[model samples]
Target: MADQIRPKWALVAHGGAGAISRGQLSPEQEVAYRDAMAVAADAGAAVLRAGGSAMDAVEAAIHLLEDDPLFNAGRGAAFTAEGRNELDASIMDGATLGAGAVAGVTTTRHPISAARAVIEGSTHVMLGGEGADAFARSQGLEQVDPSYFFTERRWLALEKGLARLGLPIPARPTGAPQDLSGKAALVHEEGKYGTVGVVALDAHGDVAAGTSTGGSSAKRWGRVGDSPIIGAGTYASNKGCAVSCTGAGEYFIRLGVAHEICALVRHKGLSLQAAADQVIQGELTALGGDGGVICVAPDGQMAWSFNTPGMYRARIADGEPLVVGVYKDET
Candidate 1:
């Protein structure tokens, strides 16, 4: 009976958020970002329109984004202080409240899939470091050499980050790309806050959310951001809405932005837009954090809010056309 129920559906996605502005991206660069987002969102929307579960739709969307170099997730993830790539991702099912996550993953080809494996195949809600990669390997997920994630654009960004922070720049990765002469100007404030996320409402009236990131460039130690932490960067609930956030990971973590948004909607009788606005505009801003979120509810509400100059975002409802935005003005 429950499986036969069909309901309104929608999907929303974000390709990170930060001080992105109108003149910041070249016309070609802007088109590339928008096209990539549309393709990813379309992939997920196709799944939902085909009667896939919210969980599957969310995974389908993020999986495509993780593969794109334009957005930081898998292939173009940021470099750590050691110049190595460490990925993080998380996903949640609104129908069951079952969530999974992975942090500091080194070799998994798709961190989003690895996170889903945690929810469906393992007892744990989260896994980290070598163990997380090992578990992903055991599940037969694709594995890549560390160098596979390295891009010259990100390598230079690492140096700039170290310089800006007044820290020593580390040596390049062992098998790094050789052509680092150019592409530096192409890398700017946007890459520093790069992450990808998706929120979907499937035909079953279930909502699911997922988020993936490469963390901050030149992040020291084993710093894990809010991306892989349940209730922090990702949250979904059948009772209200699903949310995926990209921002200053530290503040988002402290504020529990994802879960907080859903809580406001489900508990405080706030509308989805109001709840999101209050969090991103009021609470997060008050705390001196700037970023954005994409949300979808089972009732067909799709909303996004960011305090920065712009956020790369897209959303699509059942029969509607896909809409995308890069700057703050594109409502």
Candidate 2:
């Protein structure tokens, strides 16, 4: 009954937040990234154009990013220290405070769908680890062979990152606590890359938010970061806005970035843009964390903010469904 608002409707996405610079990527890579982003943006916009729910548009857009190996979500997820792939994802519906999440799930074909199931299934606001995986099975979510997640590119990238950490190559010692100083530096060095995020305003004016990731490269077991957490990595609330973020997980967890943005809007009387900008440029930076986010307010306004050299981002509006991806300065 509340789904009849005719907001302008918008969609935004990010591939991943990291330190990608013009100097690092060839023109060819830039073109390919934009091409893929356009494809994803169009898919999302199409759903919105057809009077689909904001949830549908958000999921459609994110699903495109998930399937693309160019980004680090589902198919192209990074590897765990054990050389296995575990994916995490979450979704939120702004109108209801309903949310769902999955962690350490290796077999679900659509991690995001599992998250949505959790959002609608019960009164529980979150689920994790084996519990989340089991919920997926009970819901009849598609399952994939574990090997379907393997990616040589991601593996080799993590291996190189480990090498730069001054750790032994190829061995990644068993049961040894990693020396994180060097690894942290490497992570910071590549900290500008953003995560795959989606925010949508459907024809009915409802707002939805979603985020998915492979987590940090070579992350430890049970070391779940913010990606699958509602208030940290993503949040949606009809009272103000819907947000999805990508950045240093440690700082995001510390700051509660997503929920904090919504709170500033609901409590301080700040606009969605003002709250988001403040958090990204003020609080997050002060905490020594860097990254960016893609968001949409309930009014259908949109924004992207980052403190790093570049963020892989794209946007589509009601008028045009073009996908535009950028890695460096925006003119």
Candidate 3:
């Protein structure tokens, strides 16, 4: 009898995508970001090594990023125009085509956990704002005061955004929405591109993807980004691939970048690498936007592509050691 090939598992993750120029980040800061990516990848790889589902692995990896203040997901989230935190997250199970998402939730400490709860515990695919926070509380997930999400670094970012717009700083930071109609909100920073995501293929050949973010800095009127939108920021399928995106949220949502990559792979018969490159480089670039994606195929093949100066990413495939990178040159 011929020897049967064993199924392989793979994992990939990204912090964000933007102009992470070499001259911008100090050696110490670069080491810190690379170490954080390694830790997140290790968390997911450990689950896959133990025969856990891809869903579990993705969630585990994202949870670590959310907890760490280094990435801009949970604890390190950016502030809105109102100088408050509003989080968004989404998760998908490729084997079952099940997805859950939460948007604009201010009190949920880990929005990704709440998103998973919606997938496994409820029939709804998405929940938003106070309703999402209510559902998260009912699920017994941890809840924190809105102030728990406050970080001085992010506060300064918001102030910088207002300054860029030539808007006067608010006398007191309140939750009231600001009128930002003609003002261009900054999505990318020199060092912090602003979201975190993961994609994983498990021992059973199932794939999963998830994304979490604080939306754009200095955003107003409850702006919700592509991170909580399934086809835009996160997608997974056993027959195609799993993808998670980070970049300009509006362009991502309008372009359906995540699903478009999978469609090109499924219908056009393009390899995972080709599909990802086309979308990140061709489609998104033409739309006058910048971002990045991390994708994993069913057979444990993986690709990470970005149209920016750099992206924080890590990957591990079948019997391979974990690889981490922060700049385009490293890849």
Candidate 4:
């Protein structure tokens, strides 16, 4: 009976997850976040409504989110221990199991697009550092100076994170904001971890997933998180579902969070929601990790789960209104 009403197309997205809760933001901040998410979700859902491929829809959605400074992806990404913006992203096509990723990209304007470029143009599954940036440039994708990703908010966050770790802060990037006054209180540890991702089920019954991030604040030694790693931060399969995860990268990588959810749905016949809950609520929690995920299936099923106080998420399906969420209780 539930399947009888399933929509032909659906999409879901997340703007990272962690220790978020009610009152975490002021009225203005909440509105900004909600509006940003809606715009991104609508951009993706519009493609599916037009009979576009799931991969196209996923890419379209992430492109918008990556551009917006409200979420941590492209322009507003966090800083590393060296105070540089090192971005990572990945995308997967469920129907073909074709995937592409880029890690530690410092100059690509849109890492998600760089990832898509990899899948469509290259034989390699992943590219990193200067090579990844070079590939994006060769593809004619927009390239920015390293400091284009700088945000006063993120800079403040980096300073606070480093202070807590007793690490000496590096000098600011070349073209950074000159003033840093009165912004220290705004940077909280809980807000330092963030990523943006999307999953879509298109009219052709195909699914796809994509994720992008600036990685953990104040991270050192070229650490790459789960966002750029297939089957960890992102996984999709038309056989069951598509999953994009956000949280502590180490745990997500160990649990193979994204792939495990799809595996449970495909192999154990668990429902999309059940599989998501099992992986995020049960297995991930048992490991003492905190985070969340957004998922969508070709059958139009959609679900999200997070162990933290909140997760920034949204979803849309054919013949249904868009739904946006933040706090855990909003579930």
- What total of clashing residue pairs does each candidate reach? 0, 12, 0, 0
Residue-level lDDT of model 4, residues 145-196, one tens digit each, is 9887887888878898899999998998989765444322233235658899
Clashing pairs in 4: none
RMSD in angstroms between candidate 2 and the native structure over all alpha carbons: 5.9
Q: Model 2, range 63-169, lDDT digits (tens) per residue?
A: 88877766677866776766666788999998888888888787786788888988777567677777877898898888877666655566676687666766544
For residues 1-331, write the lDDT of model 3, one tens digit per residue.
1114434789999999887878777676787788889999999999999999999999999998888766778877887887778999999998998999999999999999999999988999999999999999999999987766766566777888889988766543444324322111222254334799999999888999999998888888898889999999999988789999999989999999999998888889898999999998999999998999999988777899998989999999767888999888886
TM-score of 4: 0.96
lDDT of 2: 0.76
**Model 1 C-alpha lDDT per residue in residues 1-331, reported as the tens digit of each score:** 1333323688999999997998888886788888888999999999988999889988998988888777788988899988889999999999999999999999999999999999888999999999999999999999989987887888878888888889888777788667644332244458566799999998778999999999998898899989999989999999979999998999999999999999998999788899999999999999999899999877878899999998989999777889999999999
| Highest TM-score model number | 4
Stretches of model 3 off by over 4 angstroms after superposition: 1-7, 168-193
* Best-to-worst ranking by lDDT: 4, 1, 3, 2
CA lDDT of every candidate: 0.89, 0.76, 0.86, 0.89
Q: Provide the RMSD of all predictions against the true structure, rounded to 1 decimal.
A: 2.9, 5.9, 5.4, 2.2
**Model 2 TM-score (2 dp):** 0.88
Model 4's lDDT to the true fold? 0.89
